[model samples]
Structures are given as structure tokens and as C-alpha cells.
Target: MSAPLLQIDDLSVTYWDRSLLGLRANGFEAVKRATLTVDAGQTLGLVGESGSGKSSIANALLGLVPPSGGTINFDGQDLATLRKGFPPEIRQKIQAVFQDPYSSLNPSMTVEEIVTEPLKVHTRMTRVERHEKAVELLKLVKLPETHLHRYPNEFSGGQRQRIAIATALALQPSLIVLDEPVSALDVSTQNQIINLLYERRDALGISYLLIAHDLALVHHISDRIAVMYLGHIVEEGPADRVYHQPAHPYTQALLEAVPLLDPARQRARRAERRGRVTTDMPRLSEKGCPFSGRCPHVMDRCTARMPPAFTVPDGGTARCFLLDDEPNEQGRSKD
Candidate 1:
């Protein structure tokens, strides 16, 4: 197989909290030993709850936050070694579309200026060429040429997001980091934007690191899915397998939380869930399984040491001992 367009190996991002006197205090690791890959022209959906370090990964990729450890190899170059924003050429190949379109786009700039800004910075295109390209990009996002002269405030939430996406595509970046691209829009608008992104990605042959809380929404577009909980990847595999046959307990709970369209099924699932008591997991330490506290099948050994990634039958890996070859009395690996 060919090398992936983006390869993240044991990536970690930590934030330090200092005292008022500039004394060293405590540090919080937002991402811990996270590893994943995205092939050229494919989407990798990263699904997790808020504060699960999804945005930290996005920021690390965009050079907004530096990696505390590990390497981020994008298109064969190590991003962690940059020490600053990615160089001009590398920056041009990696673009981002943020969650809030209202703030992501400069409210003062016209749509033409906003979309063409990347072209201005990355290319030697003339004003006329930039304007023409901006019009084309607007069309690509299903917006009108007339809207080119309008400001962001003049458009609806969905229109603003489309404009943001157009800006990201201006340079034809190989990878686009979408940080909750559709979470702010209404349901219909969210679907429209998702479809627009899918269309653009296929037409342009671009890769995406799509971050969202909605598993079903992400699953619809992603070729693979990775689940994050409290900064660690608990499960990852093909989207269909992860969605249909989640091997991790946390993944199962997340899928169950998605409200079903059928009322009877939804009620039945909810009733079944109520019978199980779940407690919030304790503060994550450097050792042991992160989901032990809340996991219904958690065993004594689960609290003693971190479980290795066990291969699941459905072409995925789950960070649980249930799949081990020789489980103990509490369903933990004897090893």
C-alpha cells in the first residue's frame, strides 16, 4: 500500500498551568499517544465528546498548537519539527475550516477577498485572476457570483460555512482539517454542507480530518472512524464496522445515545440502558484503562494496568480486555 497523505504517530499535546509568579504548576495532557492516518482523497472521521481533545489535534495539525510529543508526518514532512507555522509551500497544502463560520471568516472582508486571500498569499495570481478563481470557488460551494461582493454578516449560517469551505479550497490543499464544520448549522443546512464537502473532496481529490460529536453524521462521509475518550483513542476501524459493531464499551454507549428514528426502538434502547448503572470515570492517570470506571464489563485488572489494543473480529482494534485470548475471572487478560 502507498504511504498515507497524513500519518500521526503517538501524538500528544499538553497544556501547562502556571502560577501567578511564573512558577511551574500542573500540566494537562489533552492528547495522549494518539495515532491515526488519512490516505490521499479519503476522510477520517474523529468522533468524541466535547473536551475530548479533538480540537487539540486539529490545532496541532494546523500549527495553532505545538505537539508535546511524537511526530506528525504530512506528505512525508515532519510537522512537529517546524517550531512555527508551516512554511509557505507546506502551509498552502494544508488548509482548515473552523466550526464557527461567523468568526472564522473576517467579517470586514468581502466574500471575494476572503476566498481569494489564500491565492494572494500562496500564488502569483493577479487581481483579476484571483477574482475569477473566487467566483469559481463560490460556484463550487453552490453559492452565487453575486454574493462575492457581500460580507459574512450578510449571509446565513450555512452560507457563511460554504464561504469558509471555499476559502480553504482556494489553494487546492491536499488535506483539509474540518473542525466541526457543520455543528453550528441547522439539520437541513448541515446535510447540505456535508454533501457539498463530500462533492468537493471527490472532485478535487483531497483528504479530510473531520472532527465531530455526531457519529452518524461523520460515519456517512468517513471511510474510517476513530473514537476518542478523555484524550485516548479507545477504538478505530472501518466506518461501517465501527458504526454497526462497535467493540469498545464507550463506542457502544455513544452509538446507543444517537436517537433512533423509530420511536419503539428508541424507547426500548433507552429502557435497556436505564437498568445499567454508570459512574463517571476517575481522573485519568498515566496507567490503566481510561474507561474502567464507567465500563460495565470492567474487571479488576482493568484498573491495575492499561489494556493493549485487542484485535476485534470486524477489522478494528478496541482498547479492552474482553477480546483477549485468555480472560481472567473478571474478563481481563491473564497476561
Candidate 2:
């Protein structure tokens, strides 16, 4: 069988903090040994709170930032080995659509220019061909060909995002890093953009690393969903499984944070949560489970060391000791 389109193994991204004197004080591991894969023609939704390393992973994949450790293998090449940065050909095979459509696009350039920029740089396509291809891309994103002549300022937030997506697709990339691509739009517009992306991905056979903070919204278009917290991938599984049967306490908390429609049930759930949550969330720790401080299922062992990624039956892996029921290195059961 063919390998997955993209595979990330034990990837870690670190940023150094400067002291008052301008010397490097400490290194913060934004992403800690996170591993996941994006199959060809499928979407893997990466859901996490702000500063949970979602964008860090996206940046590493895009070659915008250097990874402090581990390897990123895309289509069989180790991107981490490219010290100078991705070559032109590799860059053409991977593209990105970021949040804030207003700032991501070049306002000075026309839609035609924005959509065809990749082609001009990476391909031998002539001006006429590029123009025709740009129009075709606009149609793929459900934009009118006439809109291509307009600037980003002339379009709504959703329309501008569509243009950005069209630009990302111009290269026909194997993998596209969608970093909060629709979070800026209205609910209806968000659904429209998500549906458009889903359709185009299936039709064109492209893979997506979709980064968002909304699990429910992500579950709508993703085949798999990964939940992150405090630089650790706490839980990941099939979209349905992870959303419906969250294994980690953090995952359950995230799902519960989504407001329910029924006021009575919402109130009841909130009360239950209030009863369980006793302390404030903890900061990142060098050792031990990242979620241990606030985990409802926290155990003594949780604070002793980092939890291993245990296999969740009928689902994906999770970094929680609750699932570690087997004998330990000392030959005694954890339970």
C-alpha cells in the first residue's frame, strides 16, 4: 500500500525566551513530541486552545519556522533536514491559508494576481493560461469569474477567505495547512466555507491539516480529530469517536465547553462541571502529565511522570494514564 501523504513523528517546536538583559532565558516547547498523519484526500482537524501549539505545528509544516526536534516526513522527504528551507518544488507541493483574510492577502494585488501568483513562480504557464486557470479556480471556490478583477477590499470576509483558498489551491498542492480558515466568518458563512472546502478536497484529491479551536465545527469536515492541550496531544481519534466518546478528561471538558441548545441541560451540565472543577488550571510542567493539575481523574502517578500515548480501543491514542491498566516496569498493575 502507498504511504500516507504526510507523516509527522515526535515533532517538537521550541522558542527561546529572552531575559531582561537580552540573553536567552529559557526554551519553551510549544509542541512536544506531537505525532499525527494526514492521509491522501482526507482532512485531519487539529483542535486546541490558543497557544496549544496548533499554529506551531502548522508553521513547522509550512517551513515558516524551524522545528527544534523530530522529523516531518511529507511524501517521503524529511522536511526537518532542509536547513535552508523548502526548495521551490517542495514549496509548490505545500501551501497555506491562514486566519484573518483581510491581512493574509495582498490588498494591492487583484484577485487574478493573488490566485495566479503561485503559478507564475512555480510553473511555466503563460499569462493567458494563468488568467484562464485563475478563473477556473474562482469557480471551484464558488466565486464569480468577474470577481477575479476586484480587489480583496471589495469582497466580504467570506468572499475574501474564498479567494485565499483559491490561491492556496492554485498550485494543486498535496497538502494545505488551513489555519483557522473560517473562524473569522459568521456561522452560516463558516458552514458555507467548510462545505466548499470539503467538496473541493474530495474532488481534487487533496489532503488538509485543518487547524481550528472549535471541535464541533471541525467535526463537520474532518475525517479525524486531534485535541491538544498545553503542548501535548491529549487525544486523537476518528472524528465521530473522539467527539462522541472523548477518552481524556481534557477532551470531555472541551466538548462540554460547547454550549448546548437546551437551557435546562446546559445549566445542569454547568452545575455538574462546577462541582467537579476544584482548582485553577495549571501551567506547563517539565515532567508529568500536562493536564494533571486540573484533571478530574488525576492520580498520584500523573504528577510523577509524563503519560505515555496508550492505544484507545476502537479509537486513536491518548496521553493519559487512566488507560494504562497494564503492569508497570516494576511488574505491578497500576490499578
Candidate 3:
């Protein structure tokens, strides 16, 4: 197998909350030892709800947030080792498309200026060369040549996102961390952006670290899927297996929450309510499984102690007691 484009090992990040007494208190752990690998020319989908540490992981990888522990390896180099600053070679090899295009791009610059800025920083190309390259990049994203002169405000949401993507590609980066790249756009526009992403990947041999909450989009684009809950990855594997036979209860609940189109199947699935849950959810503690309080198949062991991630029968791994035979029987007895 080819060497992975990106490799993260035992990555963890935490925040310290100030106490009223001026004492230091640990705030919620934003991320916990997430290990994942994305091969060259592949897309790895990071799917989770808000507060699930999706953005935190992305920030850590981009060197925006320093990880408390663990290492982020990109293109066979450890990113954390370059604490002094980003190396020029690595900078040109990785780029980002943030969640909001409006905030990410410079409102003062025209579309041409925005797209060419990276090339200006990394390359010694002259004005004429830069403009020519910028136009080519815009064309790659299906933007009209006339739009190059317009500012960000002149374009619609989707168009602005396209510009952001074009700017990311300006550097000709091998890897792009797309944080909610299409969430801000309409459904129709979302499809357009997704198609553009795939087209760019195919044409440029770029890999993607796609972070989003949209399961449908993740399932469609990702070669592998990692599901995060609270601050940990509860389930991760082939997209088909994770979606079809989700071993983790949190994964099951999330899948259940998505609105399906089939009327009959939707009704049948929705009618069978799982179980009663309380509004006052449990806080994240060092002990026990994070999803224990919210899990329908939760066992006494879940709350009593931490559950080790176990390999499922078909494939993949899940951090839940439901997969443990002892806990499964114990949970069944409780049910």
C-alpha cells in the first residue's frame, strides 16, 4: 500500500477554564486521542455533531490549535515538530477551505487577488503569470472570467465558496482540509460544490480531509468514515459498513435522526421509539463511556467503567459495551 498522505496518532487537546476562585479547572476535553490515516488520493470523512471535536481536530492538523499530546504527520513529516513556524515546502503542500467562506476570504480583495494571493506568497511568478494562473484556477472551479474582477460580496454563497476553494487550489496543495465546505450553501448548491471537489481531486490528484455532519454527503464522497461523539471516535470504518450496520449506539441514534425519503420505511422506523431519555445529560468524566448516559443499549458496566473499543464481526471497531458479550447480556437483562 502507498504511504498515507496524513497520519494522526494518539492526538488529544484540552482547554483550561478559569475558576471564580482564580484556580485552574479543566474545561471539557475537546478531543481525545484520535488516531486516523488518509492515503494519497483518498478522502477521509470526519462526521459528527457540534461539540464533537470535529473542528478541533481540523485545527490541530492545520497547526491552528496546538495539541496537548500526540503527533500529526503529513506527507511523512511531523507537523508539530515545526513549532517555530510552517515550513515553505509543507505550506505549499497543504491548504484549507474553512467553514464560512465570507469570513475566510479577504472582503477587500477582488476574486482575482484572492485566488492569486497563495501563488504570490509561495511562488516567484510575475504579475502577468500570476493573473494567468489565477484565471486558470478560476476556470477549474467553473467560475466565469468576468467574475474575477468582482469582490466577494458580488457573488452568491455558493459562488463565494467556489472562490474559497479556488484560493485553496491556488497553492496546488496535495491535501485540503474542508471544514463544512458545503454546509453554508443550499442543497442544490451543496451538490454543485461536492461535484467540484470530486472534479478537482480527480484532476489534481489531491486528497481531502472532509469534515461535516451531513451523513448523506459523507457516505457519498468518503472512502472511509469516522464517527465522533462528545470528544472521541466511537465508530470508524468503510462508509457502507458504518452506515448499514452501525455497531455503536450513538451511530445508530444519529442514523435514526436523519430523515429518510421512503414514507413507509420512515414511518415504520420512526414509530418504534427506542427508549426514554432524560433532558439532563451526563457530563464527560474520565470514568465510563462518553455515550453511556445517552445510549439506548447502555449497560451497568457502561456507567461503572470505561469500555474498550472492540472489533466488530464483519469489520470496523466500536467503543461501546453493546459489542461486548458480557455487557451485551448485562444490558439485555436490564432492558
Candidate 4:
């Protein structure tokens, strides 16, 4: 009955367009009316293609970018009010782990410094206390105390990411924005990091705003999954339901893009896709639905008006009209 740990309501992020004269004109909205919630100890996986504005949401949540509209309430505090980065009080409650571990950590700082930096900045812990905590943190991340003095360059890509995760956890933040946390690593390393993250999330009781491009990968760790197309959240629901039965065409395409392990099924999927229509939809038709131009199930009405989020019968919601029940006016969900 308590409010969710984090709630984003109709959040929008826009960058102004400039003419040849360099004056601000109509802006390009990178995120549009994005509404989502992450309960305490829950993982919300946000998946989308490149430029789909998943990172924009992360940036806005981190206070890196000021949102153009809507509100971001965290632990009952409105974070959207802070135009610049949130103050130390709010910063200590939220943290981030970026995509590339190789570049995210400062090569200059040792593992101890990197891991306990948050403590130094945010707490009154003494040198010995910070050192002891850093050692414990290294252990928490599955690394030994011997590596505390080593630089980031000494560790492998996966190890550096582990250190980064440790740093994000040092403050014991309620929310962590993991922006493609494992994408830069190899398949084996990626799985290792993901498993580690899953273990840590359970042990620490932390909530995560996990952003990634792979729906299959996100489904593995997310309690709920939200799919973004361009800037709109096309579909969202429980992980199993959204992964097995996608409600939006864009979500279906994302799932279909994942390679099947069975060779025959992979070949058959390719063949089926090749047989489908490849004609390009008109550019002007993008005014209504963001995905209208590319949607196979797009209707004439789709080109005239944007679709609202219609509740799926099982769970979650999708901004697609195909699920609408013409016979029952009350079937539509207001969620």
C-alpha cells in the first residue's frame, strides 16, 4: 500500500533544433510522455534500440539532464525540481553504473579510492573506516583485498565493471541506474556480470533501472519489462508475459531479432522475414503514431491519431489499438 520507490510521470526530454542561423527552433523530443514505476527491490528493464531515449531517461533520473516536462518522484521527493545535478542529500540516495567499464572508472585512482569515493564525499567516515569499508566492498563484489591498491588498468573488463558496481553500491543507494551495464563485455563476461548483479540485488534489496538494447537479456533479470520505440513506451508488462506474448509490433520485432539457438528455427525465421513486405512507409505518416511508418499492423486510423496505452488482458499495457475491444466500450484500461 506504500508508494513505489521511484515513479516517473509523463516525463519528456527535448533538445532544441537550430536553423542555419543557429537560433532555437522546434525541438526534437528524445523521450515522450514516459510513465513508469519501480518498486523497492524491483528491477525495471527498459529496452530499446539505439537512440530510443533509454539513456535519456537514465540521464534525467541521474539529474544529468533536466526534463522538459513531467515529474520524477523518488522516495516521495520530487527530483525534477533540481535543475542541475541533485544536491549531496539526493545524490547519496541514487547512483549509476555506465555501459563501458573500461572508460567509466578513472585510471588514475586505485580500487580503494574508486570504491570508497562516495563515502569520502558523503560521509564523515575516517581514513581507517573508509579503508575497512572499501575492503568489505571488494569482498562483496567477489574481489580480494589484495587488489585494493591496484589501478583499474590492472583488472580485466569484467573486473573493472565489478569495481564500478561496488562503487555504485558503496552509498547503499535506493536506486541505481544501470545504463547498459554489461553490453560492452563478451557473452561469457556479460552473463557473469548479470548473475553477479542479480545476486547483489537480492542480497542488498536494491531497485534498479536497468537500460539495455537486448530484450532477451533484460527479460532474464527484470521483474517487469518496458519496451520503448523511438521515444514512446510501446509495450510494458510482467517479464514473462511481455517476452512470450508481445502486444506491440515493435516489441514483437525486437523479440524476433534475437537469434534462435536452433539452426532450423533461425533459418525459418529469416525466410519468413524475407517473405514479408519490405516496402517503405511514407515519411509524412510518422506524424501520428511514432511507429506507424514501420508497423505491419498499422491501420488507416493509426496514421491519423496517436494510440493510447491500452491494458492487456493478462497484464501490463501497450500503446497499440489492435488490442481494443470494439464490442465492449469498458474493456479499455486506464492504467
Global lDDT scores for all candidate models: 0.90, 0.89, 0.84, 0.89
Give candidate 1 regions above 4 Å deviation: 21-23, 277-285, 328-335
The candidate with the higher lDDT, 1 or 4, is: 1
Which structure among the candidates has the greatest lDDT? 1
Q: Residue 257 error for model 2, in Å? A: 0.6
lDDT (tens digit, per residue) of candidate 3 on 1-335 = 77788998878888778899988797667988887788888888989889899999988888887788888899878886666667888888888998787788789999999999988888999999999998898899999899989999888889999999999999888899999999888999999999999989988999999999988788888888899988888888888888888898788777877888999989888677534543347556568888887766667777777666677777777877767777444332211
Q: How many steric overlaps are in each model, in order?
A: 0, 0, 0, 0
Q: Which residue pairs show collisions in model 2? A: none
RMSD of 2: 2.4
lDDT of 2 by residue, 16-77 (tens): 99999999878989999889889999899999888899999999999988999988999889
What's the distance in Å from true for residue 228, model 3? Answer: 0.7
The residue ranges of model 2 lying beyond 4 angstroms of the native Cα positions read: 18-24, 327-335
Residue 92, candidate 3: C-alpha displacement in angstroms: 1.7
Clashing pairs in 3: none
Worst 10 residues of 2 by lDDT: 326-335
TM-score of every prediction relative to native? 0.96, 0.95, 0.92, 0.95
lDDT of 4 at 42: 94
Candidate whose TM-score is highest: 1
